[model samples]
Target: MQGRTLNFVTKSMVKTKRIPKQARAKARIAAILSATDALLRSSLPSNITTTAIAHTAKIPVGSVYQYFRDKNDILEQLYAEASKQVEELVLAEQSAVDPALGFDHINRTLLQCFWQTARSHPTFGALTRWANREHSFVEVTPGTDSSLARLIMRTFEITGINLPAARKEAVLRISVTVVSAVVDIAFEEDDADKAQTLIDELALLLSGYLA
Candidate 1:
């Protein structure tokens, strides 16, 4: 879990700039990010501009420039923050899971947390969709796949499963890929019932593989 969290934190740190030092600076940065998040919820990512962010944030355009190099910079920070929240959520669930109860329960808890996070943060889906386009603001990768694999290995370790060196990685990689696709489908669906059905199906699919 720490390994996966560190990967995302390191990746984000490399892309983020203009660290907030003072209280006002921190508040201003938060406002900028908040404004950017709101704009992303309603408008297309391509249509959003730094000037518009500044206007929404009620600050000068120069202030937005002070904290963020550009809109992409803001998007990068948003993604970074979202990654941290997800890592924290998974870790929190990890502590609550009893190894005796097994990975089925653990998987359900984690999946529920993931769905809740996405639902709570409207910008997460928007940023992800935007980041995949041809003129994407930020480079996207399969970072979540490795993160999921690491978390699964930790769970297996806790449960005293004698997973082989070669097969452990292979199983987890395939599990993460398939589960991620299913979750993506859930996120894309408009009907809440259908989305939840996808999540539940993912849980069952993972339990069959992991157990």
Candidate 2:
């Protein structure tokens, strides 16, 4: 499980025809992803097609095929980009946190950062729902050096919490999984206040378990 999770994170979830190098190529790829993102905001992943994406991106269908084999390949890349954005936001939030703050404060701060990113990207909920159905998003495991686990470990260090290496890994793994589940549920809520309430409850849950 650990090895598989690591591979999914470290390597591309799906292979593209080639990696973009030149500025024009990179811009074109970004446009393709942006087009897909816009489509997902209103359409289900399964309902979207590569030709539709090409039309939205204002490129030829062959150009879309130049980078992606099909719509699923494009969706996988879109999810990967979303995950990368979340990790980057968490890291930025972590840097600004005060070391003097306890686990609860830091946890909630980071959770808010995550929520903000997920909320801003309207495609996230639809993409996640699709990935869950397709079994494309794998469960994260301990010792995969996941971004969440590393951030949690850093939080422990800042708060001066001590535990055996094995025990710490177990706690981190469980905490990440629980937070992910709660956040997913929160994202599914149509009401803003209800979604935030779910996140607040999650902060309390983690405080009791980790702090």
Taking the tens digit of each residue's C-alpha lDDT, what string does model 2 give over 1-211? 2311211233435577779989988988889999999998888899998889989999998898888788888887777777777677778888889978888888888888878877786676676666556653344232426666677778788877887877976787777677666776676688999999999999899889875
The candidate scoring highest on TM-score is 2
Candidate 1 weakest ten by summed lDDT: 1-10
TM-scores for all predictions:
0.77, 0.82
Q: Top lDDT: which candidate number?
A: 2
**What lDDT tens digits, residue by residue, belong to model 1 across residues 109-146?**
87888777766776766655554452221222234345
Model 1 scores what on Cα lDDT? 0.69
Every model's Cα RMSD, please?
4.2, 3.3
